[model samples]
Every structure is written in structure tokens, then in C-alpha cells.
Target: MTPHDNLGYQRLFDDGLSFGVGFPLTNQNDTMPDVDEELRLARHAESVGFDALWARDVPTYWPSFGDAGQTFDVWPWLTQVATVTDELALGTASVVLPLRHPLHVAKAAATVDQLSGGRLVMGIASGDRDPEFPAFGVELSDRGTLFRESVELLRTVWREDYPEVESSWGTLDGEITLVPKPTTETVPLLPTGYARQTLEWIAEHGDGWLFYQLPQSTLESYLADWRDAAGDTPFSMAVQVELADDPGDGPEHIHQGFCAGTEWFRDYFSGLNEMGVDHVLVGLQSDDPEADLSRFADEVISPRS
Candidate 1:
């Protein structure tokens, strides 16, 4: 078996396209979520065959942004979910790399990776929230540099026991060591968006890519570019969906996704498969998420699986 077979999320990409569910499993857009219900839906997703459960890292809730993104700190929430579910991958749709200290991020991520038994896949970003930069005291202009350095730091700390390393962030003097290393050789890192880096840089460094929804034409174009730069590194995207009650309803554009019936989703996902998409993180909007999840599993995921 290869390294891909050893990592939970990587396994999902081995064969063909696999599906995952993003957090805030319900349609309730409130800043706070009913934690119990979210957990219930998460486990149900696993039981029904979703490959992974993704959480967003929103350290502060900017009212203007309009979504709190599962409304819980990603580390604790994911660790708790890991205890209850088996074999389902736990991911951070993105942890803002430039905003937080790379050491803290490294330690926390490794802790989760160890606790989850190698199930963690971190999706990192340079951050796009304008207000967050100043609040964190991170310069927006230097984010691209900070982002690159942070990635290097994370890899160095995780892969080496203790090595002398210096960066604008800080210095590791080979005296201190990060404990509880990842269960695997290294934790998989997928960069979200461009993270202010060129496509070639991201392709050369990232384990995978986490992208927002895009139109088919645009996505095809992006994938073509990515393949040339990254060669078979998995590419994943998120889509929001409101499953119409009718199985025949066609797709209608919605916020970053579409409102569609089961048949339409099936065909849509199939097209994605043909396009060489490795995985998709589905964000569902429904009054009854549990029922909707089951229906989606039976209709869309099952056929594709």
C-alpha cells in the first residue's frame, strides 16, 4: 500500500470521486448550532456512506460574513466527532495559516491527527477575510510570504524530530520538540483556494487542493491547468445544495451551488466524475437534514459509489 492508502481522506480519492458533507449540517444559518443535532447528522452521514465530514475554521464571527461555520472551534469539535465515528475522515475545510502561529497550528493539528488515528486532513489558506488580518495583527500584504513560511514550518516540525529552523514567524532551535506526531509519516495538507500563491507553487507544494464551487466550464479549465502543474494530486471542491423534493427538478443556481432534484444531482456528479474531480464536499440546505442526508445517500452517493 502507498502513503495514500494510509491516510483516511487520501483513501477516498484512490478509486474515483468520493463524497463528503460540510459542517452546519442544517439549514439554520444562525451563528450557533445545536451541537447534538450536528453530531447526530455527522454520524448518520458516516453510517450512510459519506467519505468525510468537513469543518470550517472561523476564529471570529464577522457578522458581515454571515455564517459562523458550524459555530464551534474546529479542534475540539473534530476530536469529539472522532470519538463517536469510525473510519470517517475529519477535515478542516481550511485553517487560516497566516492568522495563527504555525507552531500552535502544528501542535493542535498533530494532536488531532494522533487522536483520530490518522484521520485528519488539514485544508489551509492564506485567508481572504479583510478584517481578520488587522485583528490578528497579521499584515495582509505579507500573507503570501507568511503562508509559504507556515507551510514549510508545519512540514519541518512534523517530519523532523527537532531541527534548527528560522522564519519570520519564529525560530525552532532543535531544543524543543512537538509531541504526539501524526499517526502517519506526515499529515496531509491541502491548500484552499490559491492562498495567494501561484497555481504552480500550490501544485508543487500542496498534497491536494480545496476549492470553492465553480461552473463546469471554469472548473474544467482550472483542472486542466492543475493537472499540468500537479500531476494526480487530488482536487476537491465544495458545493451547496438544496435538494428539491421532486426527483425530476433540474438545477437552478443558488449560493455557490444549485437547487436540484436527486436525478439532476446524480447526473451532475457523474459529469464531475468524467471531468476527473477526485471528491466533492457537499453542503446541504434543508429543513430536515437527517432525512435529506439519507435521501441524498440513497439517490446520489449510492449510485456513484
Candidate 2:
């Protein structure tokens, strides 16, 4: 398989518009809950036809950011989640690349990809929080450069054997080998929110893009630009949703998504599909995500599917 023969990519885009949910799938709030409950919800999502399970990389708890992506270290947590589910694609919604050693990211990602039967899609970002950069000994201003180098190094080591790589992160002289290559020729790398790079750079390097939620018009404009740059590579979005108890409830705006009925979401997703969105990472906002997830599948997913 070439770099493009990605199970996660195929799972996301093959069937047109697919839906995913962020973990800890148990709660949308900041507190991390029981792993056993998370696993149970993971199986529930798979059974209900959700296509993927997304994990967020929040290196530190910045109180200002609030949620902390539910505060789990993404790699081990994602691996645990991957173990129970048979077929759901596993992904990092966006890992902050500038804060990490590229070699570690490469090995960890490849291990997960191999373990999950090539279901890993790496969504990476440049460091965002100002505090996080200095905390990691990374300069905030240098993140764009660091992000580029890290992406280059990640692709290099994944695809090349004993690669002679030299970068700000470290150097590999073909003497030291990185073990456990990905299940594919290379695991899919999707840049999250540009990572401070140009669209052209992302298009050339990424398998796809994982973007933030946008209004339909804004999404149209961005999609137009993406099509011109990277034809047919998938473009995905992360959104928060509050699925209403009643199927017929009308639309109400939330932070980045909606608080509305299934009817509104169904049409909304249809519009998104028409405009070329590949996947939607749904962040269910209720305390009880399990119920909302199942309702979404029945009321929004199965009807269209």
C-alpha cells in the first residue's frame, strides 16, 4: 500500500459523509471518567454505525481552555479504546506536534496503526497555547518551522528504512532504526487547522485535513480553496452538537455546532456532503453521551445511510 492506501481515510471518505465522536465518549465535561464505561460506549457507537473514534492531544491542563479534550494522554488512551472496538477508525483530532519529539510521535503512531490494523489517522497541529511552548522548551515563534520539520521527519521515518534524517528535533544517521513500520506504506497524516503552514504545504504533505467547524458559506470558500490545492484528498471537520430529545426540534446555534433536532442535522449533514465534507467529528454535549450517540445514529445516520 502507498501512503494513500489508508484504512482510516477509506473508512472516512469511501461512503461519502461519515460521522465520528470524540473520546472520553462518556462525558463532554472536563472530568475524565471510567475507562470501562468508555469501552462500553465505544462498542455502542460501532454497533450504532458511527464510523470513527477521535482522541484529542492536550499536553497540559490550561484552565483557560476548559475541557482539556477530556484530559487523557491521547496515545495510550487511544490504544486502550482501539482494543475493544473491532472496526472503528482511530484518530488524533489534532496532536500538537511542535511540543513533541518527532521520533516518539512516529513510533507511537506506527504502533497504534499496526495494532489497530492500519486504522490510525494522525491529525497534527502546531503548538497553540503560549504557555505550552515554553513549558515544552519549544519557542512559540518557531512552531511553524518545528511543525514543518516534524511532519517531514514523521513522513520520512515512516516511509524510509533507517532514514538519514537531520532536523532541530534530532538526527538519525541510518545506524539507529525506528521499528514497527505502519501497517500501510505510511499512516495518513492530516494537518489540523493549518498548523501555521500554507495550504499548498499541507496539501503536498497531508493525506487529508482535519478542520474546525465553520458556517456553510465559510466552509464553501475553504472547500473551494482545498479542491484547487489538493484534489480529492478528504477534508473533515470537528463540531460540538447537542442532539435534542425531540426529533422535530428546530435549529439553535451552539459554540461551534448546534443544539437542534435530528431533522435539522440530517439536512445540515446533507448540505455538508453536497459541499464535499468527508467526515464530521461530533462532540456530543450532554452528560449522557451514550444515549445522544445512539439517538444520532438512529435519527440522523441510519436514515441517510
lDDT of candidate 2 vs native? 0.87
Minimum summed lDDT over a 10-residue window in model 2 is located at 26-35
Screening candidate 2 with a backbone cut-off below 3 angstroms (N, C-alpha, C), the clashing residue pairs are none
TM-score of each: 0.97, 0.97
Q: What is the C-alpha RMSD of each candidate to the true structure, in Å?
A: 1.3, 1.1
Model 2 lDDT tens row, 1-305: 77667787788878689999988787744666777888899999999999999988988878787767757888898888788888878989788988989899999999999888888988899957788878888888899999999988988888888789888987789987778899888888899998899999999988899899998889999999999999999999998899887878998989988999999899999889889999999988877877888889998888888
Cα lDDT tens digits, model 1, 258-285, are 9999999999999999998998999998
Mark the regions of model 2 whose C-alpha exceeds 4 Å error after superposition.
none
Measured by C-alpha RMSD in angstroms, how accurate is candidate 1?
A: 1.3
Winning candidate number (lDDT): 1
Candidate 1's C-alpha runs over 4 A off are: 1-5
